[model samples]
Target: MGKITKYLNQLIVGNVFDTPEILEAYSTDRSVLKIKPKFVAFPESTEDIRKLMRFFNQIAAKEIPVSVTARGTGLDEGGADLSSGGLVISTEKLNRMLEIDPRERLVRVQAGITLRELNTALSVSGLTIPIGGHNNDTIGGLISNTPVDDSAGKYGGIESFVERVEVILANGECLQTSRLKKYNIAKKATEKSLEGDIYRKISKLLKTNAELVSEMSKNPTHDYSGYPAIVKLQYKDTLDLMPLFFGAQGTLGVISEVILKAVPLSKRPSRVVATFKELDAALEFAHKVKSLRPRKINFYDLKIIQEARESGKNLDGVIRKLEDGFVVLVSFDGRINSCVKKVANIQKEFPRNTKFIFETPENRLILNEFENALAAYLNSAKSSERVPILTDFYLPARNVSGFLKDLKVLEQKLDLDLALFGSYATSIYSLRPKFNLEDKDFNKKAATFLRAGAYIIDRQDGKLAGGTPEGRLKAVVTNTNMKDAEQILYSEVKRIFDQNNILNPDVKLGANSKFTLTHFRSTSLPKIML
Candidate 1:
């Protein structure tokens, strides 16, 4: 331990700590998995990262096998940022505003910067990235996991906003990627290093396996599961490698810095909390609200309210008014009067018992509070350790209510309670189930439930990874859902980016159920150290 720590400290320009305290601290992320890494590196500069990657490359086939998992803020719920007996690169210190092209509505920032920090700085310029996340989530993690955010409904997915990325590849070489022209592709392929090799190999792979790539594009499960579909890799005249790494979960390469498209800060949007006695009524009303093209419609079932109370967490406003039902947070981009009319038009479609709260400030702050209320249960002293076993599934608006009801049936069958919340319009989910982490049967129970839950979702035309990418945890369920061609194509993609299989090996593309179950963590820490 001393030898490795000393070598790591001397290798990177930033700090490397293997102290028991530090190792234990970095072991647990927001996910329900814990993997105590051999060392945690805090590289201050891109050069430091390059040096480390070069070192890893040199040692790739040696006695030491290093699998690198770089995390922005360790907020990935799918266990992507964790690995056993390897180095974890903490990107928190790499945060820096390299450039902000306000004129072009673009911002260049280190991937380590949190969305909240970036927007806090961008507020002066009246600009922001619309696909937002937890305040602690780093921009790198945002791009890596591409988790479903309510804001994506109005704007788009994180993939839509990423203009360019500077990634440190497996061989410790840097590749600056963006939407590239045909000539650019040719030029890149002609290069002599790993960069050119990647361009050349992937181009051939896609061209040779054109049918498989196209088939993957049509597979809903592959939408956010593994690599971006090869068909979606290229447009008419340009090919962009940035999408390939969007949800790669650090298994492909390490995100160093990125140039992201920013939009004019939205004006104060009117928000309302609508509560319904029945989920069917709530989901039906949510669809009507979605037709208005509101910025966001966040839906939470009755289980959310129940969990909050069980955990001794109090939800304010109309959210608590629900005795046994669902709550929807609807936000609009215009005046309060416009919001009122939008609701009036759809109010008749819902149950007469449905209650609405037209909150003040007309901004998402109030709406955000209601959204954060779901997470507030985690802070409760009475809250048990809730494993996020069933996370991030998406369904069509038509299947949400029905499938959710089916989920309840499975829950009762398994006798495991779940907390459900997600963006209504897009049907991206963030569902977690309550469990006692200390229970010896947890792993088997979780695996059984995941398989059954996935069965229900698959039959209902729901994507297992609609909102979140299939990282280490969900990869098990999502992998089985992928077609044989889809699996082969993604494997080839990973081989192209990482020949040695050193960059987060077996993560998004090839993780199995055994690997996932073996790493189910029994311990957890506070979500945000800050």
Candidate 2:
């Protein structure tokens, strides 16, 4: 047998599934892209990863295209397409906590460990990872994407908590990268003209400094495109590997293990719910909180508030309208004693009319129930039919109010149903009325709205927000008019980390690439060719 076949069979303990069902399952992410892998391999341990890397190295010797793709919970940016054809290295089986150091306030876990699992494990030790979003994300995936959510203002993000990382390179070399040793490796990598290694070192430096910039620009959430800018910010002049992988999105290498910093478990947890009359009013309040730089801040629109109320989730009368067609919620969480004082301070900035709902333990239970029911309710509602698309964009935090005004104007111009919501400092998402009908008129209208939105965002120096582009619509929406050199930043990074273009080769960012199957199939990639 060929070396690839023999190595995979002999060294990996995980399952290898080549069935059509498995391929279909692995073909798409939450985002658009649709190429399928020739095979899927599930590796259970670092040893299994070592075996797979050896196999990949052997395959690389032949110079055939290959890439590694993985999902913590299958959350992707679009059309669920896997535009690259290669082996899908599934990390699901490699879920184990190697160490938890309470004294150092760090934990080491295998790539497949989900946030929920890690948090639960940490709970036993009376500690917790400070940053997480939506609960289901994998530790590896979060590190790869480097998301900073509610706690970003204070604790920073997944990237900040990352003390060290173990990764397998494109050629199957296992390397352990940390802050202290980053410069040495980076210096050598740079001297050797190794683009991938150099980028990794630079990224680590960037991550170190991202917290400061991120705090100031907190109003509209930052982008997590080619890689987290934090990597460059923290280690821009250093050897930090952070830049190489922060936004590699699993292209450069597989993160086998990570050591992350954690916060002590809150002995007394507290929650504060603040209500606003108008969306603008809530936004104004968010700006102040951003100035104070609180630990966590989340905003909920009227639609979500209504869902919470109607479902009889513990949020009874939690959200009442101050004006027509507007609702807002601000939730604050922290340690009990200090949290009360912080909430008091936050309340002073708001108008006397603003309502406050202090969450008891019972209220917390209700909030969970309400949030859990929200996804289903939104999915089933006919109102969603009116909004066919949701688009997100972020500018500097200070520019958010002006941006929202422009958005409202677009809503009026398009005569489309629209709702906007997001974290005050980090991001804002605009939801267009769902169009359930399959008629050409609906598609055309949706397209028009999307084009208009994209145009406005482009004019404001915004690119697509949230996830990767999946379809033609996403391609157009995210396509930037940036000059070739600027665009190459993304493409060059992609080429370096995803050298063979093996990992999700179809998802091109910052460039003028179309999101489509035909685009992926084409030999020569063009800016707009689909």
Candidate 3:
């Protein structure tokens, strides 16, 4: 091992692994990228991370190409947190709830704690973070990924809940967003203080580029691809730097701790599935149901339900009851009486031809299973040689039907099998395509298909990759679509935070970055299809 690796082993109290087995295990995430890291360090505390950052700085000064990336549960769709040959800082050991202020309705936690664990602890106070169905995801990962939940129309995502965060800069110095709140006109401006310097610089940048920021804000997408539009910085009267880290994908700095706003748990929750015989009709009904203020509104294509049935899981009772068409699921949460009243209101407003399947408390568990089974069934439907390339994007409610039609046309033109599912409330949809990665010709065609799909979304004035942070795949597309002003602003912000480009290098900023299909783990498998 080199000096840096040896020093990291001595500094971190947890564990540092360099073995082939461990490296191989950390190589791939949910995406198809496979780049084995040179060293994997499990950090147990913020102090360890400080030391690691300092080491990175030292190596970077010596003209070494060393970089660092922090990972949570590795549940990301793409390789946002994955590194090729750099230091991988695994924050799993730092899992701890530092403070829970029930009165303030906020919780301060070590970034590595899982969502499930955090909610379990908060249950005592009858409060919980409102992120949906990602119990296995880590808090840090969720913050970085910025995933939109089923209830995004109601509660929004991590961006809405995050109060503040403590991040370690590229220079090994710690910076807290909470410090920005402490800044006042009465205090003398000190160039010596890092926080003060950053605040002044960012404030000036936003003030000078007010017009550009305003223009970019008009067409905001749920995409966490690059630095968020600077318009978010200008709050009511002052600037808030917390939103900058929401969907940053850890490119700015390592998030050490976060303070999230906690909400009271719902007293009673209810869900109903409304089936429609036509896509256009289901979409129209979904827009009307939005008026009822449901906690979540989700839509699934008929193929998803068909796949579930083919698995022989005895979904006949559920499928037979519904019409052969698109399915929309709406959920409401509050008092039992209020939830019931809301359901009644939805029924009255819904189209008369639509079939409603109200799930009672006794059968609610079954409904949950049915909803979860769709994703599972789609995964099993893929052929052995075919790899899943799932892409998510957002559009306005009025454009969803047109976008769906475009997707159908694209499928026919490319001769590929595809499935769509996601949050109807937010109009954020995911396109899952099965590609034979082993065939070079097929891979080339798949790339063309993605580029074309991106073009379609752009024409619709929609944003690409809404569900997760921009990884290699979406980064290329986002970069191509970014205006000159936006690109320059994004690059400037990246340079300010990570001057040396040691943190998640080449992600969301670098000019030479390219999205390629050669780095996947499946490349090592035999050419034969399973």
Find the candidate with the highest TM-score and give its number. Answer: 1
Candidate 3: deviation at residue 242, Å?
1.5
Candidate 3 lDDT over 1-530, as tens digits, reads 66656767887676777878978777866666677888888988898888888888777878886878889977666677677688788888878999999999899999999999999999899998877846878888888778877777788777778888889888788877753333561141355654556676777778788888888788675667778745687765667677788778788789999998999988566777877778887887687767777788888876777776667555554443453578888887755466556666766765776777787767777787777656555455444433435555787778877777888888898887666777878777777666655665765675677788888887776788676667766766777777788778878787777767888885565523343455655453222211
After superposition, candidate 2 runs with Cα above 4 Å error: 1-11, 32-35, 50-63, 78-83, 180-221, 228-238, 307-316, 321-328, 335-353, 361-377, 382-392, 412-416, 428-451, 460-479, 509-512, 517-530
Order the candidates by lDDT, highest first: 1, 3, 2
TM-score of predicted structure 1: 0.93
The clash tally of candidate 1 reads 0
RMSD for each of the candidates: 2.5, 6.8, 3.3
Pick by lDDT: 1 or 3, better one? 1
What do the candidate models score in CA lDDT, each in turn? 0.78, 0.57, 0.73
- Note the residue pairs that clash in candidate 1: none
Question: Quick one: RMSD of model 2?
Answer: 6.8
lDDT value for model 3: 0.73
Q: What are the per-residue Cα lDDT tens digits for candidate 2 across 44-138?
A: 77777766655665566578656556556665444322435667777777779998888888788998888888989999988988673657678
TM-score of each: 0.93, 0.78, 0.92
Per-residue lDDT of 1-530 in model 1, one digit per residue for the tens? Answer: 58867887787779987889989888878777888888889999999899888888788857466888898888788788886778899899988888898899899999899988898888899998776567778889888888777777767768788888999998899999878899999999999999999988988997898776776667545358867645677788788788887788998899999998888887777777888887777877887777777888888877676655665544564465555778888878756577678788677666566777776665346556566567765554234565676777877777776787787788789987665778887777755666666778888887888788888878788888878887878788878767777678788899888877888885777676787788888754564422
